[model samples]
Target: MKLVVQVKLLPTPAQAAALATTLRACNAAAQYTSRVAFERNVKSRNELQKLCYREIKDRFGLSAQPAVRVVKKVVDAYTALHAGIRAGYLGGERSRRRVKAESKPIAFNTSSAQPFDDRCLSWRYDAGTVSIWTTAGRLKGIGFVGSADQLATLRAHRRGESDLLFRDGGWFLIATCEVPEPEVFEPADWIGVDRGITNLATTSDADNFQGRRLQRYRRWHGRKRVELQAKRTKSAKRRLKARARKEARHAACVNHSIAKDIVAVAQRTGRGIALEELRGIRDRVRLNRHQRAIMSSWPFHQLERHITYKARRAGVPVLLVDARYTSQMCPRCKHTTRSNRPTRDTFSCRLCGLAGPADVVAAVNVRDRARRAWVLVNAPVPMAA
Candidate 1:
């Protein structure tokens, strides 16, 4: 798995200016490459970009290394777009929207840092110092002090991948490390997860994990954000930056914690985790402005990703079931109806006299979907091949 870890950098004033200059260079490089590719793709032969890069470099008196890196960046962009197209998804520079990868990226071979490659990027944190080998030798000033602990004991293993990047106006080290397979573990159990507006998640096992915690944090930051936006003063802007960082940190904490808990419960129960399919959640939210803002800010995808990664390490599998009618379906009679859920939280089934918390009923339904999916998975199919 490739994990991109971005450690905070406290650069000195002089270093900051140098890095800013570097960023401008990167922007110029990207802009130039983007414009070239746009022009090339318009022509009949877009595949001859490597030759084009050489021609441009020679014509412009630019070094091969940075210019080549620039070409590689654009190539990677096209590769991503092609992959998305293959997957029947919209990606890459398509139509009129070609957002180039503006981040300065430098690749390194794993032979230099094997074994420990999965976790940390060795090149990123070299000998407790940021020993980045960019087109411009070693980065000076604030760059060195950027890595946490100066990356003193960093090492990459044989089967690893590393990419160093400076993006979001920050330096980041993305490490791809291989995880060892577990000797004795299983991810075959069943546990239903219910995602709600009020509570982030509730399990079919009657266990409750409230999402109100996230709601609280979101509201707090949202209010401050508005107040800061209105001020527009220098001090207010500075304070807002700090506050924004704090809010992001807080969100990471909550989402990470929530994912960990769900994984833990799945491990303990020895069952697979099933989650509700929240459809059109982003657009269908009936929350107030503050609450809606908070809801939107919640990192749902990040939370799901955390659960997946943690589950994989622990030998637990995550199951996604179509939550189409889980909420309306009666866990008792298996009858799905909107009227059964007369109230928001109450699910009083008319067909089977089943009644419970709407979310809890939804949870049981989520778990049942697992069984149905299992049958679909293992059932014999008509021999066509």
Candidate 2:
């Protein structure tokens, strides 16, 4: 599996300036290349490189590899834009967002991240430093720091390109690392995880990851955001952005903790993980105004992603079962109806009177579905007569 390890760089003032200059130059060159590609109606990498390579090198003062990377970046931007259009992410053809996107060439931010190949960047894991090509010159011995696990991963598995990015007044590098996945063990049973806004996650094992604290945390942040917006000052805007980043970091940390515990249990018990297939969940469900805000801001997908990656690393299998009626179905009697869940927290089957917490019931249903689904998945196909 491919994963990214991000480390913060502690560059000297001189090195930082050079990095800033190089990044700005590369992005500026990318914007110019994008304009040319738009004007000439050319998206092919080789053709666009041929047209802009020499000019970008001469005008932007970039070396051979950086020049090539700039052109490739421009082409990639257009490719992604076209892909988004095809996927209807910007809505229908006549929608304002879609029209606006198609009307102009894609632009790159001046501070956007730039990818560096081996020719432009080299790592020194033993010394915890890096040597990188900059517009000023090659900067050597720029220190970096990361968690012990991340440093170990980088030393053992780091490969391919690394991206240089400036964020929150700091320079960082995100390096790709390819790690070998362990062979999956046959599961003795399954653990079903039900994701929700209020509870966050409820497992068939009856474990609950409650979101009450997180909800209060977000509500406080929301109130602060409104206050800052009312102030409408530059400092307020900066503070607002900081708070948003902090909130995201907190949510991600919570998810990582929850996923780690669940994956550990699954691996220990020799059980597969079952999750509801929740693609397009936002589009599938309707909510009131207050509920809509909570739904939109929920980190259900991130939690699921964490679970998936952790499971992969632990050699535990994961299954996505059908989501329909998981909450409404009676796990005991096999009865399905809307009335089974009369309240948010309660689940009572009208037929057999089976009762439990709604989220746990949903998780049990998920587990049952996965048990059946796995049989079909591994079943032998019938031979033709």
Candidate 3:
């Protein structure tokens, strides 16, 4: 499994300036390459590299390695755009539009992160620093720190590339490390996880991770944000933006904690995890004004992603099944009706008179779906009679 370890860097003023210059040069090169490629209808990475390699170095005054990464970056961007188009996530004409718009260079922010590979970047674990190649020169001994676990991964499996990021008045090294995937295990049973707005996650096995505090936090922040927006002052605007980020950070921390606990439960129980595939759910579901606000801001996607990676790293398989009718369908009676979910939290089966927490019932349905899928895939074909 490949994971990113973000380590905060403490750089001197001169080193920071050099990093800024290097990143700016890289972005400029990428923009120029993009412009030329789009104009000439050049989409191939090799072709672009052949065309713009010398031009970027000569025009941008960048060294060999940074020049390579710059060209690669442009090619990668085009590749991603094409992939998105194919996946239907992006409009077919988006790439063409972007190409046509390249006549005017896009204004880049100061924090455009630059990528560095082994050729241009080196780490000194003993000194707790890294040496990076910059347009000005090689900036050495830039101090960095990470969690003990992250540092261990750096010492053990640090591979591939790292990005230089500047955010919130601090520099960070986002290192990509290739770690060994956990050994695959055949789960004896499966646990279903239903993610929601009220409860972050509820398991079929009767574990509920509450989101009431998180909701309170969001409501408080939302009110503050609205107040700040109305102020129309520079400080108010700044504080509003900061509050948005703070809310996001808080949610992310809570999600991480919840995912960790869920994965730990799965590992302890020797069970795989089953999750509902809720992609594009917000657009699909109809909600009232208050429900819309809460549901719209729900971080179900983030929680699912966190659970997935954590489960995979822990050797527990995570399955995503169809979420349709999960909340309404009764697990005991196998009856499907919207009335089964009489309220947000309560689910009562109309046929069997069985009732339980709405989220848990939904989770049980998810688990059953996964179990059926596994059985179908693994069950042997019947011989002709």
Considering every candidate listed, which one attains the maximal TM-score?
Answer: 2
The per-residue C-alpha lDDT of model 1 at residue 18 equals: 47
What's the residue-level lDDT of 327 in candidate 2?
A: 99
**lDDT value, candidate 2, whole model:** 0.95
Q: lDDT tens digits, residues 335-382, model 1?
A: 877898898778999898988898888988888888678678768989
Off by more than 4 A, model 2:
233-238
Least well predicted 10-residue stretch by lDDT in candidate 2: 102-111
lDDT of each: 0.61, 0.95, 0.87
RMSD to the hidden true structure, all candidates:
7.1, 1.7, 3.0
TM-score of candidate 1 against the unseen true structure = 0.68
Off by over 4 Å in 1: 8-20, 42-63, 78-126, 134-136, 139-170, 178-188, 227-249, 279-299, 351-355, 379-385
Which candidate would rank higher by lDDT, 2 or 3? 2
How do the residues 168-233 of candidate 2 rate in per-residue lDDT, one tens digit apiece?
899999999999999999999999999998899999999999999999999999999999999999
- For each candidate, give its TM-score against the true structure: 0.68, 0.95, 0.88
Model 3: per-residue lDDT, tens digit, 1-385? 9999999999999998888787778888888887887778888888888999999999999887888887777777777766765675643455666545444433345477778998899999989999989888888889999899999998898889899888777889898889888886888989999888888899998799999999999999988888888989999987887788889999999999999999999999899999999998987888888788888789999999999899888999888899999999999889999999999999999999999999999989999999998888789999999
Score candidate 3 by TM-score against the native.
0.88
Q: Between prediction 1 and prediction 3, which has the larger lDDT?
A: 3
lDDT of 3 at 196: 83
